[model samples]
Target chain A: MTRLEDMVGAAVRDLADSAPNAHDLASVARVRGRRIRRRRQALLGAAAVVLAGAVITPYAVLDGWNGGPRPQPVASVPPSTAPVVPVPSTVATAPAIRKDWWAAPVRLPGDLVVTSVGRREVNGPNGVTAVAPKTVQEGNVALDRSTGRYRAFSGGYQGFDGAPAGRYVMTDDGITAQIGILDSVTGQTRQLGHGSGRGVEWSADGKTLLLSLLRGGVRLIDAKTGAAVDREMPDAIALCPSYCNFTWLPGGEEIAIAQRDPRVERSEALPDTVRDIRVFSVATGKPLRTLPVPGVPAGSAAWSPDGRYVALLPDAAEEDGIRIAEVATGRIVATLPLVEQVRFIADDQILTVRGLDVGVYDLTGKLRQSSRLPQDFLGRGISLGRA
Target chain B: MKQSLEDEFTAFVADRGQSLLRIAHALTGDRESAQDLVQGALAKAYARWPRIHGDAEAYVRKIIYNDRASAWRRPGRRNEVTVAEVPDRAAAGRHDQDVTDRIAVREALLSLPERQRAVLVMRYLEDRSVEETAEVLGCRPGTVASQASRALNKLRLLVGDRPVSMGGAR
Candidate 1:
């Protein structure tokens, strides 16, 4: 036995010796097993009835029909109708690098999600109010860089995703978790659904919000009206009963979700050892295509402004880096070692943060410019975008 | 769910329930969740007991590991939590140092990613061989080695420069 092993063993020694409870676990397990068996039997019976109906209905309709010729069978729809425009792996497609990108003011398509390291004052709702530092730790405000105005959110919002002005998808840290959209302008939050709010993202156009529920599955709702979008999409119960992370594709009409292989679930392999990113249409909740790219968490995925490429912090970065992949082909275009946060500032320029330093990189994975953040605003912060 | 099968399951649970609960406690770091995990695994085993009664413990253990692995990914769980650092202090006695070290290791273990933590538990606490752990996890032996190494490095970071002693690296 090694010293390290001894320490770990000793740590749980008392726990190992604890006595079993007085409850009859065997009886409880039997009851649960009975429920499982009953459910399976019911499902089997339903399946048999469906099979019978399928066979009988086809024969009944064909026997009564007397058409000149049987209508030709409709062709099966292809998995994807999107164009496959593959770029040569050797060529760099990004625009000319701007060496002085960091010198000028940092402009972004969305608000900057920041966690204040110290007390600071900025333009607030009423007037300039002293905002406390580290109020919500993981970030609580959406700072509009142009006007220097900030909208602070309550409910322990992690500030992972936000819209242009001050709207954000946040989950309340209460007994009954309420996933909603918080409009800083009106200081009101309209509940959209119930979830952990940890896996929420806005669509590329910022009109819809995708919320991953704790019970299982994702929900799409209109950002403005708080009304449910994709009314025909599969509900949480029928979609996924296990953990799932979802993000809207370039267009709000579709979404990408992480799904593990069935073999992993059956214990033939390690749990969640392999996962594929599956794309589905938001309207009909039908699978469209499967991206060979590994899946990532919701907020970690960003679609380029042109909607041609997506930058993701994959489950396992090859060299502790982020990957930029062509959306249509799912081919990795570039890999950059930008550890913390990544977002596209323009169609070609990518903004990244590694620790407190920010770097601008092109599509070819070359660092064009780099600069350190201001002393006061420096801390672990996530750079959020409108998408 | 025959009476004979039921009797066999009852006897098995009575014999090994506490041990299973101990493993669950190590995996989840809480007694309530440990009980829930053990009960859930046992119930799953019961659902297929007639076919798996010969190797019931192995089947139940696999369920326990896989269920706990996926449970940690729940958004309501600890996935989004950021722990404040624990300040280190000079120890007054050997007993105090031992207790502090144990607590620190426990915290560090809980903070690891689900797979990495499972690797550590299987390797150190259960004293399982590398190949055995790999088979149970359904991964290549190389992956088990890498995960264990990464997990230990993270533990060292969290526990602050304590000697990890890689003399037992299998």
Candidate 2:
């Protein structure tokens, strides 16, 4: 070997000499393999017989991986009407399974159908408190964190209006999507009418539905009584020449809007959009205080749960990481990876898909919990917050 | 069928996990990142078990190399190798061959572009032929040869030795 080649060999040998044995990695990889394979097969539907683990991990990762069966949509029958699921026979003898504070992931069978969003207090194994998705088998629902055991959870804006939780507006045929409210305690559906507007969004209080209409205006539909109120956008915010993206603030009284430059035609250039962000009052339908958030591209603004900050994904000329800027200061406090797949899971914690993993991180940018799904899970549409 | 497939996957990891981890460490220069890379590749492998089960290790190794290369390119996410700037010249013919020097050598190797570093690892420590490295990297044999050459020359400069010590002390 040449001198450099020999030197390279020496360096590699030195560095690798202290490497750890792969026994631990093997165990973890086996688990990851089973979970991801099940997720991939989830696209093919539940007819394929993927074996359940002897003692399924409680909080392994990726909350909803449907390996067993797709629950059918049974809206008329009450959730308790379906046959009760006996505890997994192995629970007593099975080894310890990892637990997440949120929920214990179990293989969902085809029978525990959920027709709409319901507010049933599901106490997960090991103190995981949740508004369980309306399911016949509340004790044995699937791992989908967004809609728990929701079956008619056909389609909605993912993570946009925080759908698929207690209440969700969904469209199966693409032409219409209605918002459904459920009792979080009983897991029973409340007959909220089909919100008659495009881009339907649930209010923070879950009492009102905010929808954007194509005819050029926004509407507020009562989620409980199905009352409708329409509001037209001021000409300044309307006429989406380039594009428009907006999100409701926590109080549900205001919205943060980003309107791109109508004249530039190209989307990325700083000149293509308004220099200052336009905040509009939902009650008045007029532009409120305008904050300077220059160079923000179209459709990249998501408000934090606390309404104190807006998370912005990187624009063309900016660094490629998620930037969280305080709405009051417009000063960016943190920049993190997972720009495209980021949602504020809590006031301080964000849920993100990094590589094959779905991880939860706190405001201090500390990774609190992370679980890997399949590599193409995002592309294959592993259900997240909304859609 | 599920148990059998899992058994096959478990067997593959048990047999080859250690060697793969070693390769990952050498490529990434850190245990955590190596584990991350390996887990990622293995997840992909598991996703496509039926088609590539016959030759899963090779497939995963290929993934590792490709991902390491791309990791170097991602904006604001690349592993920045922060090294004390190398001296312009080693004190004439009096460089000490100690632990510090070993560490410097490791840093110098890691400081190389990820593809170049991976090429050197494949060609030298892994003892792969130019063609094999090319196959793993999905590039021409000549490209692997060139990257290996550049990597070695850069290493020689940074490590400050004409014929660096190949002793296993480090």
Candidate 3:
């Protein structure tokens, strides 16, 4: 072969080596083939299948793919053998599936006090407590979902709002702020440690907290005991020129930082110039791998429940979509067609926002269910617990 | 019979999946995109496996080439450069030179138009003849020749001609 041809061939081989073994390619293809087949069958069956609610086709169940455990049948309504009992006209209809948390919008005056902003759910799997701003300017109000009452708490930055269940970290001052952890469930606050910090971030599992110091540095703290954990911090490049915005990879052992160009002052410059995703080991304080981002990954990245995959929002210049990428190899697995926002509701399912509608999509980027968001939904103005 | 067909398809994938992935990786320069491309072509082949299993590899390869070519038709998708940075010089060693050459070639190949990139990949990496490449890409032999010439010339310009001690006539 010509030297150029040989070099080109070698280059291709080098790139191919970086590609992880796609062992599941055949099964994924089979699943797609079945969908194509079923689509053709549906076209043939038409109204019959539509009216009958379409029997769920039995196909291969991929490992860790549950196709989203949501949008279930309105009622189980088992096959009836006997005569149906006639119900009165006043009898209520069957209960509907609970909507995703974001679907329910909270209005300022009606649902919450006008002074209270930044509504976020906390405590319990079902979110027993929701914290919002109080009428009094001194502190925030935590509303007990069960009791329908608000308890006010003092001293925490509204910007760093979301936290672990029943507790949130706060500081009394900006520069020499004494960090304290408050248990919103009980009216008690405990000093965490003798440290001065600017903001706090809870790891994905809520086991660790990343406290950004006022004088430029970060400390890892045990979320439960508030003791300083001896762990390595991100490299110097990740901290300088701008606030080190970090997104925790699942399991709280590593973090992914999208490198930014400090020279560009405009806010849009970060996502515009983001070319690499630097992954760091929290224990070693060293870079594990730097993956070249395919497109300019804009906004924050959402890690899948398994941490095996991450969903990144495309740059604003491109059409709205979620680029689902395998975390280990940094390969774009699938790009959801059109989504305004995305987060993982399950390991295999992602909650997506399209205009005013919120949709649930499987890993294959197929929409499972779609419903409109509430009229007063506070998109980024609010945060759900454990973000 | 259906189970047997699935089993046969699985066996074929096991045998030829990696080769197809390599060709796709050469075409798309990104692993996941390559896998997606291979999966897509394989899915198409699987859909008609009953009729096309005899020529499944050829059919899947054709799909991969055509899909990649079609991607060129979409505006603003001409380039899929995934390399974060281009090194100025190779380290003072032969192994480092190999890495540098690969990176430079990959970046240059990605910068080329999709059709030209396809032609070069098919000609050099897959070792397909001009006629075979044309047949797969559904183009004239003359078109393939011209595209390959332009792509090679551009690659030479993009990455300096520091060829290894390999020798052959194009």
True-structure lDDT of candidate 3: 0.50
Report chain B TM per candidate.
0.86, 0.81, 0.80
Candidate 1, chain B, TM-score (2 decimals)? 0.86
Error of 3 at A175 (Å): 45
Model 1 lDDT, full chain set: 0.51
Native contact share for candidate 2: 0.34
**Across residues A1-387, which tens digit of lDDT does each residue of candidate 3 receive?**
677777777776676665546567788788546544443444344211111101110000011111334221111212223321222122111122223322222211101111112322122232122243433222344433334343455424322232422344333232233455555456566665543322344553335666533222246777567778544342433322222334555555665556544454532112233445676667766766765544322222256545555675443222235677665555666678544345555555665543245556666676666654333332212222321
True contacts kept of 3: 0.34
Listed in order, each prediction's TM-score against the native is 0.53, 0.40, 0.39
lDDT of candidate 2?
A: 0.47
Best candidate, lDDT = 1
Candidate structures ordered by TM-score, highest first = 1, 2, 3
DockQ (Cα-based) per candidate? 0.22, 0.15, 0.13
lDDT of 2 by residue, A1-387 (tens): 554455467888876664554545655565556654554343234323222120110000111211223221111112222221222221111112233312332211211111122122233443223333433222212233344432322222111122323343322121223334434334344444443222344454445655543333456767556677866553434323212334465445775555544454541111133344666677877776765554342121145544555555443223335666555555665566633245553345555543334555554455555554322122112223321
Per-residue lDDT tens digits for candidate 2, residues B1-170, read 37888789878887887788788888876654566568667766776778789989888888777663223111112232433433344344443544445566677887776678788778667888888888887679888877776766777777675654332111
At residue A338, candidate 2 shows an lDDT of 34
Angstrom error at residue B30, model 2: 0.7
For candidate 1, write residues B1-170 as lDDT tens digits: 58898889999999988778777767766544465577767877887889889999998887776663223222212221123334463467978877777667666676666677677778877888889888877679999989888877666677667655654347
